[model samples]
Target chain A: QKEVEQDPGPLSVPEGAIVSLNCTYSNSAFQYFMWYRQYSRKGPELLMYTYSSGNKEDGRFTAQVDKSSKYISLFIRDSQPSDSATYLCAMTHLRGGFKTIFGAGTRLFVKA
Target chain B: EPEVTQTPSHQVTQMGQEVILRCVPISNHLYFYWYRQILGQKVEFLVSFYNNEISEKSEIFDDQFSVERPDGSNFTLKIRSTKLEDSAMYFCASTLSQGPPLHFGNGTRLTVT
Candidate 1:
């Protein structure tokens, strides 16, 4: 099985709607979870980061991790057209290593 | 307000030629990394560097690939003999410490013909 799995969603939502993106992993050792935003032809930008199993919120974005279920999510409230981009979920262990694994990004489109 | 920067936003080269992609990481950061993403694939870690040495590298970062911190501010990834399969978007990233969230550069699009 792939270490990390995410839906390659071209998920479309209207402006002002709430959006939820998620990923699941098989590695129980993962302690760092991150969400990255990438526009077409651009590099992935770190948007949200969380350590262990908890919720972290910044402005209109919220990241949640459930170590028990090996699931992680990014929630975007009041989505805007400018929020249209690909969302990638990544995870790594906290042992000072470099084996960060990334999932296939979910493509998002916020319509007018 | 600083960000990682990569040069030669786009590059095209022959399949057998050697190519070097360059980056300048955040000045205060000590950890550097190299990653690549194929057109529609997930971003994959290639290698990580710290204290002028490779801390770790993935299997994909094999004999044909090398990374260097040639100067105080410059980091580079060199592919010994590029292949059509080597075409991808290469990104440079840096972090303040181990396990920190990495900041990534815009990336260099390498197209091998």
Candidate 2:
């Protein structure tokens, strides 16, 4: 099985809609989880980061990590067209020299 | 806010030629990494550099690939002999330490003919 897995979703949504993105991992050693947003021809931009399990909120973004289930999620509240981008989930294990593993990004389109 | 910067936004090279991708990581940051993404593919980790040496690398990062921190601010990835499969978007990323999330540069699009 792949170490990290995420659905490559072209999930379309209307303005003001709530969007949910999720990923699952097979490694229990993963300690840091991150969410990144990428536009066409651009690099992944950091959106939210969480350490271990629990939820972290910043503005309209909320990141959740459930270590027991090896599941992670990112929620976007009141989404806008500007939020249209590919969302990538990444994680790293410090004991492994911080070699981050990235999931296949989920493409999102928030229509106006 | 501080950010990582990469030079020569695009590069085109022949299959047998050498190509050098350059980046300037955030000054206060300590860990530097090289990652690449083929068109419509997931980002793949290549190598990680810390304290002026390589800390980790992926299986895809073979002998043909190398990374260096020539100075306090510059981090670079060099491809000794390019291959057709080498064509991809290469990204440079850095973090202040082991625990923080990484900040990435815009990326350099490379095409090997």
Candidate 3:
């Protein structure tokens, strides 16, 4: 089984809708969780970051991590067309290893 | 805001040819990384560098793949002999310290034919 698993969704939603993207990881050592947004042909852009098991909020985006469950999520509120992109969940162990593992990424489309 | 910059936004090289991908990371950043994503695949880490030395590398980063911080400002990844599977989007990233969010460049799309 892959260390990290995420549905490569082409999830379509209307503008202003709340979107929930999630990922499950099997590695128990993962402590740093991150969410990245990537547009077509562009590099992944860091959207949210959280350490350990907790929730971190920034503007319309919220990142939640549950170490025990080995799950992480990114909640996008008031989604807009401009928000359409691929969302990637990335994590690394707290031992300061730079070897980050990433999910396959979920494709999101916020319609107008 | 400063950002990582990569050169040769797109490259097409013949298989077995040598290719060097270059990146200019944020000036004050202490950590540098190279990652690649094949078509429709998750981004995979290649290697990481700190204090002018390689800190870690993945199995994919073999003898043919090497990284160098040639001038203290420019970080580069060189593939001694490109292969068909080496075609991918190569991203260079940097961060001020460990455990923080990484700032990435637009990426260099490599196509090995």
Candidate 4:
């Protein structure tokens, strides 16, 4: 199994819809979880970050981590076309340094 | 907000040629990383540098690939001989502290033909 797995979603939704993207990991050692948004041909941009297990909210985006279940999720509320992008879930263990593991991003489309 | 900057937004090189991709990470960041994503594939970590030395690297980062921090400001990745399969988007990233979320540069699109 891959260390981190995310659905390669070409999930389409209308503007103002709630979008929930999720990823599951087989490694319980992962402590730092992050969500990044990438536009076509552009680099991934950090959207939300959380440590261990808990929920973090920032404006229209929320990140949730369930360490016990080895699951993580990013929730987008009232989505906009601007939110159309690939969402990547990344995790890393706090060992020697910060060597990270990434998932195949889920592509999202917020249509107008 | 301070951001990482990369040079030569796009590059095209012939097979067996050497190419150097450059990046300028956030000045105060301590950890630097190199990652690449082949079209339609997941992003893969290449190497990480800290304290002026290579802290860790993946199996994909072989002798043919080398990273250097020549000065306080610039981090570069040099491919000894580019291959057609080496064509991909290379992203440079940095973190303020170890185990923190990494901030990425715009990336350099490298096309090896």
As for lDDT, the candidate ahead, 1 or 2, is: 1
Identify the CAPRI category of the predicted complex in candidate 4.
Answer: medium
| Top lDDT prediction, candidate number | 1
Which DockQ value does candidate 1 get? 0.74
Where is the poorest 10-residue window by lDDT in model 3 chain A?
A92-101
**Top candidate by DockQ:** 2
Per-residue alpha-carbon lDDT of candidate 4 for residues A1-112, written as tens digits (9 for 90 to 100): 9999999989999999999999999988888999999998888998988989999999999999999899999999999999999999999987765788899999999999
- TM-score each candidate: 0.98, 0.98, 0.98, 0.98
First chain TM-score, candidate 1: 0.97
Tens digits of per-residue lDDT for model 2, B47-113: 8888888888999999999998888889999999999999999999998987657889999999999
Tens-digit lDDT track of model 3 for B1-113: 89899999999999999999999999999999999999999999999899988888899999999999999799999999999999999999998987668899999999999
lDDT of prediction 1: 0.94
Q: Could you tell me the lDDT of residue B11 within candidate 2?
A: 98
Model 1 residue A72 CA deviation in Å: 0.6
| Model 3 pairs in collision | none
Q: RMSD per prediction, one decimal? A: 0.8, 0.8, 0.9, 0.9
Task: Write model 4 residue lDDT over B24-106, tens digit each, in one string.
Answer: 99999999999999999998999999998898899999989999999999999999999999999999999988877799999
Which 10-residue span in candidate 2 chain A carries the lowest summed lDDT?
A92-101
On a 0 to 100 scale, what is the lDDT of residue B58 in model 1?
A: 91
